[model samples]
Each structure stands twice: as C-alpha cells, then as structure tokens.
Target: MTTGRLLIVMNAGAGHSQAEASRAAIRAVLDAHGRAYQFFLADSGSALPQQAALAVQQALAEGGAVIAAGGDGTLNTVAQAVLPHSLPFGVLPLGTFNYFARAHGMPEDIKAATEALLSARIQPVQVGLLNERIFLVNASLGLYPTLLEDREAYKAQYGRSRLVALWAGLVTLWRARGRLRIVLEHDGQRSKLRTSMLFVGNNALQLAQLGLPSAQQVEQGALAALALRRTGLFTVLLLLLRGAIGQLHTADKVLHFTFQRISVRPRLPYGRRRIKVATDGEVGWMSSPLVFAVAPQPLLLLCPATMETPA
Candidate 1:
C-alpha cells in the first residue's frame, strides 16, 4: 500500500535568497525525475498541522515518502506527524542552520541533495520528549531562549546575519538576570542546582574541544544534558570570545553533563512569568516542573548509509 511518490512540505519564509534558489533547483530535480510529489506551503511552519495530516495520509496510502524542505522546525513538524505512522522522512536543508542535514551528510546543493534523497539510506533516530511533545534535537532554557526570541526580531530587520544575532544575544545576556532551579537524576544520583541556562540533547555533538566543527549523531539509547551556571561578567565575556573562535572547551561557570533522564522545577510558581524553552530555534515559555526523558528510536530518518560508520 506504499506509494512511490514523495511529499514535499515547505515553509516559504524560512531563509534568504540562496534558500529560494535551492528551492527552485529542488523543484527542477523533482520534475526531471517524474516523481509524483506535492508542494504544500505554509506561511509559518506552525500551520503545518493542517497540511501535514492530509499529506501524510495520502503519502501513506500511496507508499510515498515525506520530505521536509525547510529548516529544523519544519522537519520537526513533519516528524511529529509521520513518525508514529512509520513513514520515512527526508530533509532538503533550505534553512538558516540545517543542523539535521549537516549531521547526516546531506548535500547543501539542492539538486545534489534531491538526488541523494532518492537513494539515501534510513535509520531510526532517537527523540526526546517533554511531556507529550517530542523534540528531535536538544531543548534549552534560560538566557538562550530569550536570546533566540530577540534574535528572531533582529533577523527580521537585518536578515539572517549571524553578526546581528550575536549582537542581540550579547545585549540580552547583559540585561538578563534570573536563576533556574534544575534537578538532574542519572547514574543513581540526584543533584539540584541553579543555572543561567540548561540544555538537554537527544544526542551529543563531538567537537574538537572547541565546541565548533562538531557533529551530532542520533544516539540510539542515551540522552545528554548541559547546565550553565551564573558567572561573573568577565568570565561570560571570555566564554563568548571562545565560542566565537570555536574554541570553547572550558568555562568554569558552565556545567556540561549527560544523563538519560532529568527533571526541572522552577522555584517560582507556574504562570505567564515562567521561563521560556527552546528546541532547535523554536521558542516557547513553559511553566514549572518540566519532565524530560529519552524517547529511544522514536523516529526513522533517511540518511546516508556511510553515516553508520563509527565517528
């Protein structure tokens, strides 16, 4: 009952001029292949649910695959809808930071990427769950989320420039002051601490000790957590400098740890005043008492066969 067709879900407003060019090239490849695929556009990827349900149902009926043609957020939406049904998922990498695509060795060239998708191998990828919602990458809180929200506005005015984002983040961090209570339980020990930022990854990225030029693989059975404590302004500046140079290996105030499961409860009460949470650039505010757990092998992804090689 599987169709040979493909479903391409696009967020038309994801990236800049180059992203548009990539889209055109992808269209050409699909046309040349004579592939039966539909292009569904949504203004904001939040509207994906309406188009995704039907596209998924049709693709399932026809034995087709669903391809996410934008950024990580768009891909996350497609994954949310199709993962439970066991449909294969592919990425087109037409967004600002295509982490998933880069991690999987997907080509940045639109035509080449499409061609690779035609024959790419698939493997199960781990997903993380907070409450009932699933996150493909990592989820973060505290200063980082505020920075993301501010950067969105900044990008609106300055386009997708990393410099603008950096400036906005620095400004936000300067004015931000709050402590987040986190309780982490793993390896038979529980610790409670206050931090400026906390991040939990479905898979860990191995960088050259500089925290850059890193690679994140879908770990089949584990979860990773990072906790950043409050630091003096001078230390924060040093960390920023190292991060910019991609040499951020050690920051005395930053606590990086990995665990299979962790729980976080804000000392503050749950309300609109709650802290914001972010996952792969998507931002939202959440109330206190957030539970995070590993959803092992929750979804299947189409990736290059060579990715299975040991890193």
Candidate 2:
C-alpha cells in the first residue's frame, strides 16, 4: 500500500480455471479499490522466471509491490526475484494446494485474494533455499520430483484435481525405484542414510497437515527433513497413506529431523554429478552437495492483518 503502483506478474500456465476470468476478477478488485497496477504476463514456460524478475526490477525501481497471480510455482519465481531486492511481494493463489497462501491466511478465491491485497501490510516471512534458489514452500529430492513430473503429466492429460494428483502419486510410488545414499551434515553432526526420498518442509501448513513432528519447528523458522527409510512399493504406498491421513509422525520407517541448515551429498552413479530436485512443484537439477538452508533474510510478503509472523 505504498504510493507507488503494483506490478502483477501472472503466469500463463495457470490453467486452474479460465485465465481471463481470474484476470477480470483481479482487475475488478483493483479497480474498485482505485489501485494503480500493471500486469506482466508470462506467455510461455521458459520465460516465466525472467518475466517475474523483470517485474521485480520495475517494482524495485518504481517503489511498488510485485504480485504473483498464479500458483505456488509462480509465487516462488516472484519470491526469488523479490528476495534479492527486499521488495514487497504478494500472492493470489490459483494452485491446487495453495499451501503458502492458505498457511498465511490468504484466500485462494481470486477476487477475495486481490481484495485482501488492497488492505494488506508487509511482513517478513520465512524463506528456504536450495543453494541460491529460493523455495517458498517445500523442496524435495528423488521420488517427489518424479512424482511431480507425473502429476503434471496427469494434470495435463486429465485435470488438475486432488484426485488426479493422488492418482499420479500412487502410480509414481508403485513405479518408484532406487535409493539415494546421501551423507547429511547439519549442526556439526553427520549421518549416512540410504533412502528413496529426502523431503524438506518449509511450510508449516503442509507439514502440520502431514502430521509431521517438525511442523512447529518449521513454523518457528527451522526446516524439517523427512526421509523414507524403505522404498519397496508396498511400504511406500503404506507410508503415503500414513502421510495422507496425518500419521507420518507415527511411522517407524520415516526419519524426521529439524535443521536450520543441512548439506546433502548424494552418492550418484558414474559420471552423474547432478540430480533432479523439486521446489514448490517445479522440478529442476542441482549439482552435487545440495545444501538446504533457511535463507539469511526473510521475504517481505504482503499479508492481511489476520496473518501472524514470528518476531
């Protein structure tokens, strides 16, 4: 709510519903509030991060907030761009989970989220980083990234519903294979583990929903590391059920811990130095010795008054 205008960065891939309808509702809210705003739409997937970064540059120069009007992935891109500049950021969730939005008390309904933006205030929100990359929600290695790929494929082929996501996850788990022998170092302690997946949670809502013991720790600015000890298809499926029903905390085969920083060195196959990693639903590769840590500086996110932040 500065004197400057709002820079809205929208991802064209947000096919959650009618894109035009979401745009119209957002425009209606801003117009009703008499707010000055500009939209920078990312028409193609390849240019989304660049577009968001461009919006951030403009917002930084003009003294305004950059609003991401898509899903968590879009939010992550905008956050990554805004993090370096210490600019105010906003979100209008159009994703399936909307964990980052909902965890911060943001309404997923486009019009309502936009309306909240009109009266929102800036707060320092926690951020997680995989090396230099920013992740607003959670980050994972191994099967989760593969599952995300399958989920996107399923979403494209069928639809973007929870059922579809769940189906994709089931299929991925059933087909899951291989173990990652990772040497983890954190807080002057070292451990070697062989697991099918290593999941680091930065969002309290998602962690709490999963009944993870480290959820409160995540809320308090620490990241939770969860690893699956067994990768057998049936065991993986049962673990998935436990996670789905918020009983992961009770599972014996899952290793859970809290950390502010952790180093992961995966024992890879010959000539392979990179591995696929997923952050907030976007998958990519990072070099060996992937380090997951709480960003030194928190993101200045615009949130409604109902949202709370740690002091």
Candidate 3:
C-alpha cells in the first residue's frame, strides 16, 4: 500500500539452514513480483527488538512499510517496534494457526500471501496490550503459559507441527495441578476466584474457533476472558476434546466474561511478585497485577481490501 518500499523481518531463530530456505522462497515471490524490499534476519529472540527497531526507523524515514514474516511471536516482536512509529505494518503468515493473519483475510499459501501483500491497503485494526507489550492474538496466565513453554520444547525435539503442539498440550494438561488464587478486577468490579487457566482473548477468529461465548465481542472493542474451574483429570480431557471440536460452549464449568479492561493480581502468601504469562504463544514472567486492555490507538496494518472490518 505504501508505494515507497518494504522492510521485511524474518524470524531466523528456527536455525540457519531452515530459515534461509524460507527466506529464499519468500525472496523468489517478491522478486518475481518486482517488489522493492529489504530483509532483517533476527538470529535470536533477545535481539529482535533492537533489530526490528532499527528496521522500523529506516522504513519510517524512507516512507515505506514494515512486514512481520513469521508466526504470532515474530509478529509480536515486529509489532512492538512498529507500533511506536505509527507507520503502516504488514504480515506474511508463516506460523501455525496464523490466527491474527487469518482473521484479516490473509492468505496462508505463500504465493497467495505474497500477492496479497503487494497490493494490500492500509487499515487500522484493534490489538490488545498486555501491560506495555502488544499482542495481536491473545494473552493468558496460569496453565496456558506452561503449555506454551512445553510446546516450544517439543518443537525443539520433535519438529514443529500441529500434532506435536497437540501432544505437548495434552502432556501439560495431564500434569497441571495448580490453581491460581487471584483478585480479578474489571468493569469497576472485583472478585476473588480459583482457577487452573485464565485466558484473555483478543482475536475473534481464534476465539470463535474455540466455540467461546462472546467471541465476537472482541471486535466490538471488548476482550473475552475464560477461566477453567478446577476439575478431575477426566473432566479436563473432555474439556480439551470439546475445545478441539468447537464445542467448548457446552462446558458448564467454564466461566466466561467480556470486558474493556482487566487486572489480575496473584494472592501468594510468600510475597511472590512475578507470574508467568503468555502473549501470542511467547511465555515470560511479568509482575503481578497484569493489565490487559485494548490499545488506545489501533495498529495501522496492511490487509487486502476485501476484509469486512478494516477501520
């Protein structure tokens, strides 16, 4: 959409050989289309913010757009850097599920996705902010973070795929036994509750696929929270099946709500201050009283014109 040029950032953490293969494939598509672009290869997670910030600065100065060319985590990295600049941002879906990209009609096929990026229009799309970080898909606390941690480990050992991800999740759930005692505050109301997983969703498509109630409210500027009640192992397995088949709405034990802003504070007796959190599948520790809210300014994204809700 920005006719100036393009700055594409690739998540090169997947290993040098594999990353280069994907890079070459993407380069072929862009070259065949005669698009003007440059690449920023992120060899490590810790360096992404610094590298992406440099790329974003250069793109902004050149009146061009910046593109995130991998999965949700990669997008999260590039987005954090670009959001501060207020320039048009783009995505090249290369991640499993591709939730954020698919919700905006981004094609999953490489050639199709490349073509869409070439002629996409600048559109303002809403995103969730986990404290000071940007999460385009979702953010969560409790068991979900553990699941992401295990998933990455499995990917390291068994390779990346849907089956491996599912296996990792099942293992985590089977071993999951802890309950979070927290004070949840939202909508000027507060409550104390115990739960295994506390998930806050921002992407309508992902929530809709999970058969969560009020999934569409996310597009209406509200986030949906799902709290899993502590249950027997068999019941938890049943819940997983339901979620997989888009029947989670039938689970009576799950608590669901919609809100504009929410705060979570862990009530630990030992004065523990940090808790593990997952934003768009990346897990890390953050101070308690985590705040999840819609960003005051929407992200300026490049998407095909056929999208229904581009602002």
Candidate 4:
C-alpha cells in the first residue's frame, strides 16, 4: 500500500510531559519518512475542534487516513467523527493505559509503531454506542464508573501514575460501595438485581490466568454483562483478589450474560447528579438512564497481521 496523506490528532494536555514526548517522536517519524501530514492539538482532549471532523473528512475525500495519538478516549472522539465517513484510523498509544491500542496489537515503540502504521493491515471492529456517544472498548456502570471518576481525580493530582490511580480506586472502593438497582434484559429474560458494579463489555476480555471461564467468550456478536451482587466489604475484597489471581468464577453473586442491547435505570434518582462513565479511558460524568448498544463493524482499525499480539 502507498503512504497517503495522514492527519495526526493529539491530546497535548493528557499526560503533560509524556504527551509532549510522544508528539515529538511522532513528528520525528513523519520527518524521517518525509510523509505529508497535518497536526492538530486539543488542550484537554474534551473540546473537539470545529474543523477536526472537517479535516478528517477532507483527508478521506482525497483517500487518506487520520491518526489518533493519545489514549483510547482521544481515539473514541476522533473515531466518532471519522468512522461515519469511512475514513481509516490509526493510533499512537500515548496515554497512561493504551487499552484499545494494546488490545489491537499496535506497537509500543514509537518509531516501530509509526512504521507499523505505514505498513499495518487494517480490520473493521465493532464499537459500542451509549445514546449516540461512541465507546471504542466498553460502556460500564456502577463501581467501575465511580472508580474511573476517582482515578481521574488522582491522575489530576499525581499525573499519569497508574499506582496513584490504583491506590485512589482502592480507597474509593472501600469507602463508598454504593449499590445500584439495575434491570437487565438479555436472551428474553428480564431480571432485577442490586449490585455494586456492572460492566457491559463490547468485547470479551482475556483472563487466561484466572482459571475461571474466559470473559472473552462474550465478544462474538453480542454485548457481555457482568454484575456483582455481593455488597460486603470482605466479599468484595475476595472477589478483587480472585480477579487479580485470575481465579474468579461466575457465581450467584456475579451474574454474566450477553445481549444485543441493554438499558440501565438507576433506582436512585440521579437528578442533576451525573453518573460516572469511561469510554476507552476517557472519563466523564453522564446522566442516568443510559442505553448502550453494539455498533457492529463501525470502525476501521489498523492492527497487526497477528491479531492476538499485544503492543
């Protein structure tokens, strides 16, 4: 394939120094290859430039690709704008955790990643949408979303330290184990459950070490739902331990199901209070009564030929 026009969208404020370094590396690669490209920067990664979508559209009009150079959230924003136009997308994996990029087998080495992008095979992947908002990885609620919000606060204070975010999550998990009443409908079954956390995955997660059944089984054509009913602190801790040790299993307290769509209404009135949510590590506060569905084959992702490989 020929090297085409590329537009690089970067989140300059995401990881501060780290983002800057990644930007420099990207520029170096572009210079080395003498490739034609355009650079656009967003201060906080929250505000999308009015011209961003147009720029990508213009690139695609001329048969080009747009590269997202931050974390998954950045990719989600860019994807929302570009995918509908059938524009090919690339990722630079410059966030604290590059889950989407890593999962897709993009290289972590900046130069090599750039080279891979220049020669990588492209595949169409399914993306999930929550009330029209696109999520590249998963749309989750309950404790995970709460923890995501908490993690954001720690990231603001401690920068991109994963340890800091993990510590903050642990603290929040211990103090506020708020139970959410959820009504889940899957496979023609409607059930009500009180749970501390509910995870609805766009794709199954690999849990090789955890002798438990693989969550990856849910990735086929439907959405995978995992709900935890246990509210006791000790029980929660034990579950966490099991997850850490890859020994967690689907049990009565933990309900796992797969479906084409789901609607979540919290029993507690959300009012003006927003529920926390994260899409590909881009954290935000959203209103309750969330609806999520699979947007099957919505994104054209650049992945390595060996799909199972991780960057």
Best by TM-score: 2
Off by over 4 Å in 2: 1-3
Sort order, lDDT high to low: 2, 3, 4, 1
lDDT of 2 by residue, 35-140 (tens): 9999988876667888888898899788988888877888898888888898888999988889999988889888889888888888898999998898989999
What lDDT, from 0 to 1, does candidate 4 have? 0.71
lDDT of 3 at 238: 92
* Per-model TM-score versus the true fold: 0.87, 0.97, 0.96, 0.88
lDDT of each: 0.70, 0.88, 0.86, 0.71
- Distance (Å) between predicted and true CA of 136, model 1? 1.9
Q: Write the per-residue lDDT of candidate 4 for residues 92-177, one digit (tens) a residue.
A: 87766666787678877777788778776667777777766888767777788778877888878887677887788788878885
Candidate 3: tens digits of C-alpha lDDT, residues 103-217: 9999988668878888898889888988988899989998899999999999989988999999999999889888888898887889988888899898889888889867778
Candidate 3 runs further than 4 Å off: none
Residue lDDT tens for model 1, 213-306: 2223234365566666777556677887876675664556666655556777756655444667887778877765676787644576777656
